[model samples]
Target: MSVTAQCPRPESRALRENHPVMGADWGPFNVIDTAKQDWARGWAALKKFTEREAHARVPYEHKEGAYPLGQWVAEQRRAYGAGQLAGLRARRLEKLGMVWSLADERFQKNLEAAKAYYDQHWTLCAPRTETALDKPVRQWLSNLRRPGALDDHPEWKTAPEAVDKDWNPSWPADWQRHYAALRERVRDEDGPADVLPGFTVHGMDSCRS
Candidate 1:
């Protein structure tokens, strides 16, 4: 599973400072959060094919309030490869794409659920400290950032690191050194309890929820 295409540009806080759009982007999103409002717009676009106004629709709602990630992933692969779909010539393709979009919505739901679950469990196991931390905990956070890491674990790929590097200052050299040293210390203290847990195990367990 490979993720191609560039991530969308992040909206500036200055542009969003006092005014934010209001509507259900998706989820339990409050109309107040600028980012969430943006997401809601995206969610609405994906949902267009399913709306009653559309010429076609698919019964793609997931039961758990989240779309099936594996299903969404499969459809996406089809869309990207020799199986690209569009218009009347590709009615099946367009329909599947709509379902895929619903699957995406479901994925978002799962994301929120997983984040909440981890946040709750995280607060339980240990206090937030600069020193020692749980390997599982780190993996959980990492999985949230990159869902595909669970199966592929693509370390070679680099994603957009800074939200706006030109506008925002990069981490200081000393800060990087401190961070690396902090991780090393935490790993050493963690002993052999899988000092570095990958997304595989934790991610699988999370989806079960």
Candidate 2:
């Protein structure tokens, strides 16, 4: 329901180049891409839980392969939220946080499954396991580069626009745009029959693998 933290993400090439220590300061990222109307309400009410890891074969990007959007989302929600309970201190979020990390040791297994599921030979979606090079620098960046920032980080030198200026409370502009796109409710181009000729809707994840 309410996401107050961000699961660590691998730095984009743009980010890493601009801010070498890009981890500590980015802030909470609670958005998950889903079309389920009950997501927010469901998340706000459910207890944290996990199931056995699963996989499937599917076609993607003009080719056929296997996908782990299933397992990846599981880890994305379950494993990432294991630490949320303490912060929220509310039984509801705590309940939603789960007893502990699910798929705890299945990172490698799930990643392989997701990577192979896509039709193309893609590898960029893997989870981030690396540590930032400098904690203080990263933290400064997260606070919108408050004080004692790197004098010449690429961001400050060539791209001042990359600096954070808005400080209200809602999602940043770019992310807001992204969420707007995802949260929009629009009719399918025609209908499922017109588009998905042979696809399977796998629970929340509709795919044919």
Winner by lDDT: 1
Q: Candidate 2: which pairs clash? A: 25-142, 57-209, 58-209, 66-117, 67-117
Give all TM-scores, in the order shown. 0.21, 0.15
Candidate 2 deviant stretches above 4 angstroms? 1-39, 44-92, 96-100, 103-209
Which stretches of candidate 1 lie above 4 Å from their native place?
1-49, 52-57, 60-83, 86-107, 121-149, 152-209
Give the candidate number with the greatest TM-score: 1
> What does the lDDT read for residue 73 in candidate 2?
37
RMSD, one per candidate, in order = 26.0, 31.5
State each candidate's clash count: 3, 5
Question: lDDT tens string, model 2, 91-145?
Answer: 4334433333333323223333333422121111112231122223222223433
Writing each residue's lDDT as its tens digit, candidate 1 over 1-209 gives 99899753556433344344422233243335886464344344445534634533333343213444344434444665555644452444355354434545644444444344434333212122311232343333344346454345333222212211111114442333333333433555646433242222312222121
Local error of candidate 1 at residue 33 (angstroms): 46
